[model samples]
Target: MPSHPSPPARSAVVVPYAPDAPPPQLAPLAGPDRPGGPAVPERWNAVDRSAHAPHLVAVPGADATEWIAAALVTARPGTSYLKIVDALGDVPAAVGAVLETARRRGLAQVKWEGWTTTAEEATALGFTPLRTPPGAEGPDSGYIRRLYGAEPAAPPYYAQTTHFTCGAVTALVARAHAGALPGEALDRDAELTLWRAATNFPACEPVGLGVAVHRAWPSAPVTVFLDTEDPVLLDHLPEAEQEWRAALQRLSRADAERSGTPVDPRRLSLPEIRAALDRGGHVLLLVSLATLQGFDVPHWILCHGTVPGAVVVDDPWAHAPAGDTWVDAHLLPVPDASLDAMSVLSPARFRGAVHIAPASTGP
Candidate 1:
């Protein structure tokens, strides 16, 4: 009898996945029980690490029966950042193949947000060392590589120090991007200072945040979009507290009007947002963390720019469980549909956005 022929080597494929729930496209295919089903570990299951990623890059063996290597890549405007969540079998050797896959997807760079992976291991795979000095933005954890010469300049990443400071941090980051503040000035102290000025106790409302922005930088044109006049960011508080907070929101709105800030009582659509970015404006969008982080809490993120069919954002909070770093949060490329869905808060069914004109162009 003739010997059985070897199976051809299989190329890597990007598979749609969500850590919290399966997307509609994969409706019928249940779990690993399905034929040729995915073998994604819970750790690599990226739900919302900023739009472009959490998708699987699976390379199969020549026999096409077992995985040769796999990883989760979060897409950015022109780059892809890998989370430390999962890497199976010969990951280092698979770098070239991964880069090829990324190239086909229009990516210009590939970087590994180090979890347990080392610099030597990354450098061995032709990746440049990302070990930044004591207090820089380079990967203190892992390494990175630029496939193409240079990539689109993305705003620097600044992680929120405390859980309740996302909105304040987001606004401050927008200021930094606009050259109103320095990247090095973004610290826990600055974070709390902005938080104190903007927070509605636990959360930051768009109107209030916009008011704070004008106070900090009067030159920056501030425009706020909110669909409701009712008190928001207070649904989770006690009824009595909700009333006071609601009063505060009304006061914030009045203050905004008095300060000559633009307040539009409607949601800012994706197209409108993209247009703002094109005009050199940074938008602070309030979103629900549920779609990406599994938390149903209201969150705030900065919309910096747009790519092909995606809007770029910088989410302050990194999902630590997935071992994410600044690489995952900075310049995240979220599709239009996802941002629209996440921007509409439940119970309230309202949307909130704050637009800031180019306050300063000088760093």
Candidate 2:
């Protein structure tokens, strides 16, 4: 994470306004003020800024010479989640004001990302450091403050070993949630073994991940729903790469048939996916990151909770700005409509998912 100039003296107090209040238009801090900040991160220019615009707030100083801090109480775009994106101001006070507004808005949790401050600062503001994956080390970590009394049971997070290993990581998270794999083993040797089994090398297929889980724990039942009609790989690849993808696709299908894993003819509906989660099952969902980020690649995420009109996912990939990159993708709320649109592979039009649970609980 790059360093930035220390914010102006913490003399001003944070103040919050109604959601419908007009947002303050603060000038972008000059390079000197930002210091070592990146030139421009993706989140700085999100596709839908209005959706992520935070609740309007102003931090005023008693004297005219003191700088007035500008802040927004906003949620991540594309989901009903809350976070505080602060500017040159007092972080602690900003967090305090955000929590008050969150409580008033009936939000259960609040997150702070790329916190340049110390852990003591966060704790003082009632935020707890989030758990990071094993063997992972970086300054771009985040903290979560749960406003509700009891916290939901979220699946443990596992960072993918490679760019194409998201499917394997997603499967490992589901296994950990089901107690098939010990919690500690998720970040160590066991993770490598699972990745090897789940991956189809260059590309991980839905059937491959299901077969891998079944092989690791026979007692854990696995159900796969694949769009066999259009098993699309990267369409932009050259002829040679396309042929290689075709070979991997064929291999995946043959392996699924050999393992006797039942493959549904169509994609799983949002309602059916919700029901599976209600029954304590975790789903390894295939989606296009291009829909969320600009990356045009097939990505895998673990679906563990379903709210009214949204799905809570644990994405293995973190595409946030610097000092927040690769943080825990814990219980990210994605609208059901956006998820449905992202489920199908672009150009290829293929859809697939794998559901895993304890064998004792029938599907």
Instruction: Give the candidate number with the greatest lDDT.
Output: 1
- Tens digit per residue, CA lDDT, model 2, 1-363: 222222223333344433344333333321335522442222343323443443444455565434345444555445545765443354555455556656565665677654354566666666677765555533356666765433357677777666777887888788888777778777646656776776655667787778887777777778889867544555767887778777776776777788877677787988888888878888889998765665667898999887766777888876544222334367677778888888888676778899885577954
Each model's total of backbone clashes: 2, 3
Q: Write candidate 1's Cα lDDT for 83-180 as tens digits.
A: 33334455653465566665576553566766545767676665555433224332466555554443245676777878899989888888888778
lDDT (CA) for every model shown? 0.69, 0.64
RMSD each, Å: 9.4, 7.5
Worst 10 residues of 1 by lDDT: 1-10
lDDT value for candidate 2? 0.64
Model 2 scores worst on lDDT over the 10 consecutive residues at: 1-10
Clashing pairs in 2: 54-73, 54-74, 55-73
